[model samples]
Target: MPESVGMILTLIMNIALFSTANYLAVKLSTRNVKRRIIAGVVFLLFTPVIFFSTLYLGFTWDDTGWGAGIMTVIYTGLYLLNGLILLLSAIHIYFKK
Candidate 1:
């Protein structure tokens, strides 16, 4: 529960999520350059939308107990997913072949 421990755990989790997303994106796109480009663009647009929506929900929600715990998980998952997507998409765009 220490701040340093929490930061380290968060860093590890983000790296894991980003790695998974990168793998999936490569597998899904395979040798299709066009597919990868399109997916990158689409996810580029979607990432910020998801990020802002998550922030909005976090600020508006007032639930406690199980509800709050569940929401936390959901929000974290969403934030991680979108963030990884954004990063992977940018990589793809920059390294386009």
Candidate 2:
């Protein structure tokens, strides 16, 4: 497969993952503290998963293409952003009256 195609696919997958995380966070925001905490923990755990998966993808690709490398970095960064958002939401829920 071409590097551009791989990059596009990676971007699409990143968008899907990011949107799903945000959707779940929004849905969980109204739930009880326990569920929010659990969701936050799950999100936190996902950060390392994302890191490892990106590493695997980077290594698995046959070509050392700049496009793929950039996309991988973007993917990892977005996952970290999602994790932060979820963690903050959980913190807010915990402090709410």
Candidate 3:
């Protein structure tokens, strides 16, 4: 398989795994702690996706290097979304409010 194809496959798999994991975490979280679980999962997923987005897409923001040269925006966005979900979960868990 081509390198690009492999990268795509890897990205798909990452999405699948993260989604499944998040679902499980949310399902397992206590009723009162559901939000925390979600936030945690989103945060967990976000870290890798954000990191890879920077690497694979090679984003750059002028001199700051924020966003640029992104090769896979769709997949990267999915990752970012996953991260957001995890963040919400974490917030719920930590604050417990």
Candidate 4:
């Protein structure tokens, strides 16, 4: 299998893990606002990481410079989104709580 395929498989696995974890966490929680917010944060954090990592793997394996450049742009956007989610989650968990 190609690097892109492997990365996609990893991404799919992450999605499955995250979904199951989130479902169980929510089921176990007391349904408070804080718990909901934290769950949202976890979802947000995992999504962008999978996206950026997949793009990186694809970019690294691709032979065409243009494909690599496009993937680079996508990866950068995903990275920034992940950072933003982290910052927002920190603020929400600290100041908002």
The best candidate in terms of TM-score: 2
Which is better, 2 or 4, measured by TM-score? 2
Model 1: number of backbone collisions: 0
lDDT of each: 0.54, 0.68, 0.55, 0.55
Question: Tens digits of per-residue lDDT for model 2 on 27-64?
Answer: 86665776666666777778777766665665555366
Candidate 3 lDDT trough over 10 residues, lowest sum: 60-69
For model 2, what is the error of residue 48's alpha carbon versus the real structure, in angstroms, after optimal superposition? Answer: 1.9
lDDT of 3 by residue, 41-65 (tens): 6565565655665455332222323
| Model 2, runs deviating above 4 Å | 58-62
- Candidate 1 to truth, TM: 0.45
Sorted by lDDT, highest first, which candidate order results?
2, 4, 3, 1
Tell me the tens digit of each residue's lDDT in model 4 across 1-97.
Answer: 7857755664565456545764664564433555655655665666666566655655566656455456546554544464455445555556654
Scored against the true structure, residue 28 in model 4 reaches a CA lDDT of: 48
Residue 90 shift from truth in candidate 1, angstroms: 12
Lowest lDDT 10-residue stretch of candidate 1? 59-68
**RMSD for each of the candidates:** 8.5, 2.5, 7.0, 6.2
Error of 3 at 82 (Å): 4.3
Clash totals for all models, in order? 0, 0, 22, 0
On TM-score, who's better, 1 or 4? Answer: 1
Residue 42 displacement in candidate 2 (angstroms)? 0.8
- Which regions of candidate 3 are displaced past 4 Å? 34-97
Can you give the TM-score per candidate against the true fold?
Answer: 0.45, 0.72, 0.45, 0.41
Question: What's the lDDT for candidate 2?
Answer: 0.68
